[model samples]
Target: MMAAFKVINQYWLISITLICSKILPISSETFHTRLSPSYFSQKLGKIGTKLIINGIDSHYRSFFARVQHLTTPGFCGAAILDSRFLITSANCVHSVKPQDIHIEIGDFSLQDVQMTIYDVQDIFIAPGFNLNNTPINDLAMIKTEEPIPDAHQISIGICDEEDYDMINYQKSVFGCCGMGSTNKDPFIKLIPQVLKEMHFRGTPMDESNPERFLPCREDNICTRPMIDGGSICNLDHGGPLYKFRCGSFEPECLYGVASYSKRKADRHFQTCNTGSFFTNLMYFHEWIALTFLQNSF
Candidate 1:
């Protein structure tokens, strides 16, 4: 009974995933969109699928941390930045106290990996972050009680403008990876925390759409699912919008943070592939470096 109270309010700390649907698309009409993935074959790209980039566990290595809200049992996406720091969206930890939240790692498939939970020693949100605004310096870092073992420090990446732009125009498809919300429902034992992945294409900035209000300027990058029926729905916030480098097989850079997505209909309670927005990581590279230095000692 106590376990039931834990997951009642969990949400995806990553995206509300912008890409269109996946795995056979919902229908003939749902399978075709301007930015949808080119092929409709049985290739894998779904929210619950195990991450298999180049057949390695690289995805699990990096974004293995979950910033769990102790009381609400809510969660947000986070990743290992260094031995002592885990990074996530500033809004994810903005209002909560450091002691109230915990970081859980070392688990991929909820059933397989032995989970290690750590208390947050400190919380550091980016400078000038505003929750009212969709995406602007939407970043944060948390210090653990002690350094996470180096063996668990597998996923590492950089945020440089050069690499960010290269993937922006050059890459044909980008992958949004996350282990989003696992509803804390009673009938179910809690969903799988396995890393899931989806594909989407960069879309032109749309500032005047009424159904959505995300402004994809220098700080935010908008996306349309590369395939129809794909989306990073609710409970998947603070997720990563990443892709492999040119001629490289591994995803070494995380370019953006999944912020939010528009609803399917004005009053409906579903996510739409209509559009999605993410916080650009390159924009805050200097600030992040500075923030890390200030907290290093």
Candidate 2:
């Protein structure tokens, strides 16, 4: 009788396991926190479908300065002010020392082991740069230990207040590039090995609701892609947003510096569905000019 009872209990447990498997399918969305090529391929069968959710490979005609820490590389992007100086977001270098900061310029492909890296001699965060109230005066200048080669230099000017006011900010297409994440999911960290460029236009602010986009005050410039689907993600902060002439490869005037992205209060990740915020260089023209002039002597 005891042997019979034990055998029945074993069969009952097996029956319950089978019932649970049938009720709950194995391929539920809750189990997947991240998306990948293999997951799609398995679900949709390999029918030659490709996923491109980020910017394309940028041409070498434009100049960009990549600002990062030696250990945490690709944290932000920057513009080469000259052979000896670079401009970036204050948040990128605020807490770090100059020695630990690494600046790499003119590298189309970051994977190349032969690429040269410059050392940081000094860093100056613009006055009134507050981490508590971020993206406000979110600008910084990096001084290189050795002067960068002049051959890589280009005549890029900062957009002044007059130009900013006269131009239709929402109408013109701006060129931006960075070593940012290719994937929309920031947690996945899908940073591209090559520099990628995307075209986006400034989003017009609502006069009635001026304070809707918090942390992004009147001084900041917001952007929306004119054509593409994805926006800038992590590792793109401190990058430049500039205007280029029609059919020209070289940038004309520097307007904005990448700062942050829009997200709800509860969400931990920054969404790419909307435009990203940038520190308006046009608003800080006086500060930048003064800094450059003082250092000149």
Candidate 3:
């Protein structure tokens, strides 16, 4: 029965993969018109200032062959330790060379002047990561050659283990950030947008994949938006879902990269829905310490 189930799942995945290959066109004007001003207002409410990475244009040009460029591509990532390191989803680094990935900071318009481009020297993928499950180990670390200056904008937060444990499955909120999409249309030029918060139910993992380092409970929350390859800002898998410390929204670290949804259709159907999974970073804290921070102290 297990074998049969595996075969059925593979068949379904293949069918979906084939359908996602086709490109659908959308006009820019129509795309922008579809988005309500309220949506932008809502997004801005969560994150006041936008962060842009500089040197992305030249990097994109140099490494376009690699890296999966999403239709509406810019994704949000937090600066780790004063811009020397960045914590983001593994999907962001998947299949791309170190030279290709560029870090952008500040607003979009002045990206060229404000952003800092760093060449990735090493990429560390969490162990036991499965492409199918995309479980917790869906995290990666990008090591830059040189340290970035004026990295005051880059900050890391402490993980709230207490909040994560007390989280109510039904009422919990999952916040995510990225370049917001204009519309569900597939052909629109991808614009760089900022973060947005959405409410979701917590769905934990049934069984832990310790080897791959994934831990999720049925009650863990996930975003149901159409975008894929984005990170859960304050959660595990590098970006931790954070709640504002002073208010009800203090950023707290929760789940990590585990799994994501693939495009199964086009603009007309469920094609807009792209789900990404992350691993719980807390589970692999030891690993990160041994690997990245071992020699720091």
Tell me the whole-model lDDT of each prediction, alpha carbons only: 0.59, 0.65, 0.39
Query: Over 4 Å off in model 3, which ranges?
Result: 1-83, 108-113, 133-136, 150-153, 166-172, 180-182, 185-189, 192-201, 205-240, 246-259, 262-268, 272-276, 295-297
- Between prediction 1 and prediction 3, the one with superior TM-score is 1
The model with the greater lDDT, 2 or 3, is: 2
Candidate 3 lDDT for residue 247:
17
Worst 10 residues of 3 by lDDT: 55-64
List model 3 lDDT by residue over 11-96, tens digit each: 22222222222323435553344233443334333222322111011111110011222334444343354445555567566666
Alpha-carbon lDDT of model 2: 0.65
Q: Candidate 3: global Cα-lDDT?
A: 0.39
Better of 2 and 3 by TM-score: 2
Better of 1 and 2 by lDDT: 2
Tens digit of per-residue lDDT, candidate 2, span 4-115: 3353333222222322213333243522421233443343233212111344456563457777687665478888877777888898899899988787766654457245
* TM-score computed on alpha carbons, candidate 1: 0.71
Give the Cα error of residue 56 in candidate 3, in Å: 24
Candidate 1 lDDT over 27-72, as tens digits, reads 4353242113332122332333333211112244455577889877
